[model samples]
Structure formats: structure tokens, C-alpha cells
Target: MFKPSAEQIIKVMQGKGYSVYDTPAVDWNLNIVGIRANDPEPGTFNDTLAVFQRLQGAWNICYYQITTDPSLHYLTHPVNSSGTAILKEGQYKGAYQLDIHNRGLDSGHLALCQRLKPVTVYRDSNRDNKLNLLEGKTQTGMFNINIHRTCEDYIQRQRFSAGCQVFAEQRQFAEFIRACQASEKAFGNKFTYTLLHERDFQ
Candidate 1:
């Protein structure tokens, strides 16, 4: 339950050689960062997704929410059958653009989609139901790792995320999308997402 301030997050990002969009003129330019919790348990909403921006003259956290890992459920029961895709740690610039997730259907929703460019990921194909971040095969391509929301209610398992960044609550995800829309209007459709491990903070 450790809450990180905007400064702390930025410091970690800088230390890790990640980008920090702190230009004062570019207000509301969203900086999305996902922190993977240190917990070893799979299929759990133990990660955090934070949205930071340079509002006015200061850096601030515009939106923060509890989000599951990009491959939390896939760590156990992978959907790909071939392997589970675990997003690599780093910043992917302009990797996602605003688009309709599950478009033209009842479940369609606003989301940051990875159709703009390719991203690197580790394919855990061992089928051991364990996280093999380093032992997996590295692949780079369009894997449709969208940022969206999960079910409205608090569920036990992370059934929504199959290599996508997923918010745990529906309401919070709406708020996140609103922020993203504002950023889209101010800046552009492309966005950068940075993934970090909890140990990076330590």
C-alpha cells in the first residue's frame, strides 16, 4: 500500500533511463508508467498504473489506480497456448494510439491500443505456470497489448488481462480514459508507456 509521489516516480524513471515528459509548455501530456509488484503470486491485481503530467509548472499525478500486470493471468493459464507474452521493462515511445478496444461490439470501449508501433515482449512458452521473465524468448511485433479496464466488481482472479494493461475498477478506468482523451486533444494520439519492476524503487 505504498503511495508514490510524482517526484519519486520521476526520479525512478530518470534513474532507470526512462523518459520523463516534464516540459512546462506541454501540459497534460500524459506519461503512463506501470509498476509491477514484487509479489510472486500470479493472477492477482497487485500492480499499480499511474498517470503523470506536467500541469502548469509542476509535475503531478493526474490519475492513479490499481491495475493488474500485463501478463498476470497468463503467467498461470496462458491464452496464447503457444506462450504468455510478458511486456519487457522500458519505455515504448508512441507505441500506442487511441482506439476502440473490442470495437464494433457490446464490449467496445476507449483504450490506448498498440497499433502505432511494435514493442518487445518475452514469450513464456515453458508452460510451467511460473514467471520466467528472463528465460523466455524475446519477440518484437504488434501483439495488441491494449490498455483497458476489467469487470466492475472486485473479482479474485485477473481474468481480463491477457498481456494487456488492465485497470481493476470500471469507474477508475473511465476517469483514466478521460485523461487520455484530454491528452490526445492537447498533444496527439500516440502515447508512451513505461513498465518498471517494484525492485526498481528499492
Candidate 2:
């Protein structure tokens, strides 16, 4: 029910000094934005991942899914133990491109790869399993936080997202991948991702 219109999103983007590709020539202004909910709980899919685009002077919501925080599960039992990666909110231009996930494996699938560029992320080193985003070190590097799908069935836990923008459902992710593939064919492999907090909806 927290779905936002394209105009609302554009306004928020402009307010934050972020770019909005509204040119008619630009068929797909792909945007991957994360909406952090109020009273967010760790290890739960309380967040939203929205995929929208501007095509032919109109806006379209390609897909949206209930997604978990990038550093939710890792807060308690971090993969690094020293620091948990939490993606900073803002627009990242050309931070991702199309590529295969888990390549050369049986579970390989089409996904947005972030190997082409670097992104800013907060390294939450508390390891206390709490949602304190700003109380961490800010670092910018190529932290392969690719956008990919989770399990084929119901997702009971936040096991897939280890600082990556992940999808909760497989069918929706497939649809999103198709849209990305179409966008890739129309434009190119480059993609811009924007992460937004729920408060930005105002």
C-alpha cells in the first residue's frame, strides 16, 4: 500500500538533487529504489524494492517486491564479522550492468551485476544486530552488491540478501529480468540505481 507514483518519485529525486532521465529518446530510465519502512525490523522483509522506468514520455512501474535490508541478517552474525555492508541512500549512475549470476552453475540466472563500477556503502561494525545505519564507517568500493533473485518458493528468512538488492519471489524477479533485458536491448547494459528511505516519500 506504500506504492509511490512516478511523479512523487521524480519529485523526491529532484529534491535530493538526483537525476531523472525523462528524455523521450531514453526508452528506459531504469530505477531500482529501496524503500525502508518505519519501525524496520532486522531479518524481516519489511522493505520494498521498486523497479520503475520512464519510457516514451510516460512512467511505468515494472515491478516491485518485498525486500529485506542489505545488512539486516549480517548485523548479528556478519559474514565479515568485523563489518556489515549497508548501502548508502542516493543515486548511483551506471553502477550495475547486465550479467549472469552464479555463472557456470546449475542455478545460473540473468542479473544486474555491479562489477562495472563502485558504490558507496556504510560498514556497520557494531555487530549487535541492531538497525543503526549511520553509526558506521563510510566506504566506497566495488562491493559486488548485485541485484538478483532469491529462492524459487516462499522466502522465510533473509538468507539471500548479503548487502545485495534481492527479490523475494522468483516469478517477479524473472519479470524484472525480462524488463532489464528489454531495456538493455533498447539502451545499453548500464543501469542507474537509487535507494530511498520511507521518509523521502513526503
Candidate 3:
């Protein structure tokens, strides 16, 4: 149940030489988000996925757990045991949009706006131990990979996330959504999301 902080993860990514696209002119205001799961314990329903953001040369990061399919055993897969394809690593272009009927609250309150863009995921091929720009390519036919929140308020039982990245804490998730919106307003509706290796944090 040990969760690593966003700073630690960012440090690890930097040590690994992954591109930190957080400058002002790289991609419009340099709004970038990073995520990667850490816990590998099977039957661990609420595993932690660290969230990090660099906007306008300032860092706002937090750690939150998430729920994948209840039947999966590995850290990540293209598709879980429930048939939901795991989001592959690489740079993805995304934005915020409201979803009234999304899976979260049973009362159907307005949850955080979900990410509204499909990511062009990059793969680390060649076993070179680096995420280079040349290794990135647009994934065709990969659909429904979103960054959203979970409905469950408590942390004692199994969760209900199909495949999307589901933040367990409501308040933190709301804050994240707000940051995404502000970034969108300032720099258009496109932001960058990078997923690092799960093993790096371990």
C-alpha cells in the first residue's frame, strides 16, 4: 500500500531521460500531465496511480488511487480481463468536456468533465530503454481511453471503472478537471499526457 509521490515519479522520468515537454512554447502554454500505476498486488481493488502536472512553469501534482477491472492480475495490458484495453504509454492529446450521465455518482450529479481526445500513443520498441520521439506512432482503432473519476466514495470494496483512468478522490479529481479546463481556455483544447513505466516507480 505504499504510494509514491508525483515528485518522485517525475524525478524518475527525468532520470530515465523521457522528454519533459513542460516549456512555454513546446505545445501551447506547456500544460503536461503524467500518470503511472505502482501497486501490483492482485485483488487490490484500489491501486494508486500518481498524477503530475506542469503548467505555466509551475507544478501542481497529487497522488490518487484508481480502479481497473477486478479480474486483472498484471500492472497493465492492452486489454484487461474484462476486455477493456489498457491505455498504452506515449504522448496523447486531450481536453476537458462535461459528461452528465457518466459512471460515477448514482444520483448522476455533474462530475468532472472527462478528457475529450484520443491519444496517439507511443510504444517503446527496440528495447533501447528509452521513450524516443521516433518510437511514437498514432494508434489506430484504439478507442475509449479516457481520464475520469470513480463513483465509489469509500475504499473498502471493489471499484467500477471499465477502462478509463479513474481517480478515487472526488475533490482532487475536481481540481484536476479545473486545471484541465483552465489550460484549455488558455491554450486551446489540447493538452499532453505522458504515461511512464510502472516498473520505474517500483
Candidate 4:
């Protein structure tokens, strides 16, 4: 019953005063931006109040980072900040949603606690309490999970939706983090966000 969508997480991040923004596919003036907590040791990498404030560097506002840490149990961001928001454009105005997996991590695993949506079920024609064969939806080949979701929760939701009694419990953050790190490295300069000003000419 406890399910959250990627959009909800974005909204939560913005409410915390972290500053969320979209890179703007082409016209950034109307793009939406959202800020998130920085990687494990951001303080050692930057000279800001990162320890006191868990956020990506102001200079890196355009970039979003999610990492895997062996010491953490559930995903955590800055408690001080309820969240943040930035003006931009996308699927909606004021708020929007995007699969966290596509947020960019380069891995198929995600942190244990972000947010997720429970799968929907279809009613069977038989009118029986049990799900019918055609009404069942199975996620067999699905693997990529590096997004805003907990693997255990995701699998359970999937199984519940598919009417299957099987579900995966427990997962390794390292494996998911490794994939994200690899993807992070591949991004290189792309990891950097750009601050562009709108031209009055437009």
C-alpha cells in the first residue's frame, strides 16, 4: 500500500529548498530543475558546508548524482532541507515525473529506499477473488532497477501485481552502486550541468 512514484520524489526534493532544475532540452528558461543529495564524500571533493548540507555543489546544479555506499542502510538526503524546486519545462508544469532509472546512474540497481509505485491489477472476467490467467501481469525479464526504488519493494509489488507468490528479498547496494559509478564515469563532462540564460530574442 506504500508506493511512491518518481514524480513524488521530485516534489519532495523541491520542497526541501535544494533547488531542482531541468537542463532544458532546447529552451531552458521554461525547463524544470530539481536538486538532490550529493554522493557519499562530497565534502572531501568540494569546500562547501556539504557535511552540514547534503547537496550537489552549486556549480554542479545541472548534474544529478546517486551513489552506492556500503555503510548506509536506507537512502538519505539532507534532513535540513525538506526539498527544492526550479522553474523549467517538461511533461507538466509546477511538477513532473521521470523514471529515476533514466535520471542517470549507469546501473540496474537502486538504493533501498527512494519511492515507488505499486503495480495495478486488472479484474478477471471470472468474477473470482483470484486473478485469472489473462488478468495477471508478470515481470519476468525486467532487471534494470537503478532508479528511485527499493529492490525488495519493487519485486514485491511486481509479484503482487502478477499474482505470483515469489518475490526477491534483500539486495546488495554495492552491485547497484558499481553500475551507477560505471555509468557516472561514462558521463564524464555530461555530468556537469549548464546554467543558461534565456535570450530576449526568443
Say which candidate scores most in TM-score: 1
Best by lDDT: 1
Off by over 4 Å in 1: 68-73, 152-158
The alpha-carbon lDDT assigned to residue 142 of candidate 4 equals 23
**Candidate 1 weakest ten by summed lDDT:** 63-72
Global Cα RMSD, each model? 2.4, 2.4, 8.0, 19.0
By lDDT: ranked, best first: 1, 2, 3, 4
Clashing pairs in 2: none
Query: Candidate 1 on 67-115: residue-level lDDT in tens?
Result: 4354445666777766778778788889999898878877778888999
lDDT (10s digit) by residue, model 4, range 24-131: 332212222222222222111110100111123222112222221111111122111211111111122222112243245453333321222222222223322322
The C-alpha local distance difference test score for the whole of candidate 4 amounts to 0.24
TM-score of each: 0.88, 0.87, 0.56, 0.21
* Two-way lDDT contest, 2 vs 4, winner: 2
lDDT of each: 0.77, 0.74, 0.48, 0.24
Query: Model 1 — TM-score against the truth?
Result: 0.88
Q: Model 3: what TM-score?
A: 0.56
lDDT of 2 by residue, 1-202 (tens): 2678777877898999988766566766577777777766666566777777776677877546655365445676667654777778878888899998768977667898787878987777776767557844777888877888877332455456667777767787888888888888877899888888888885
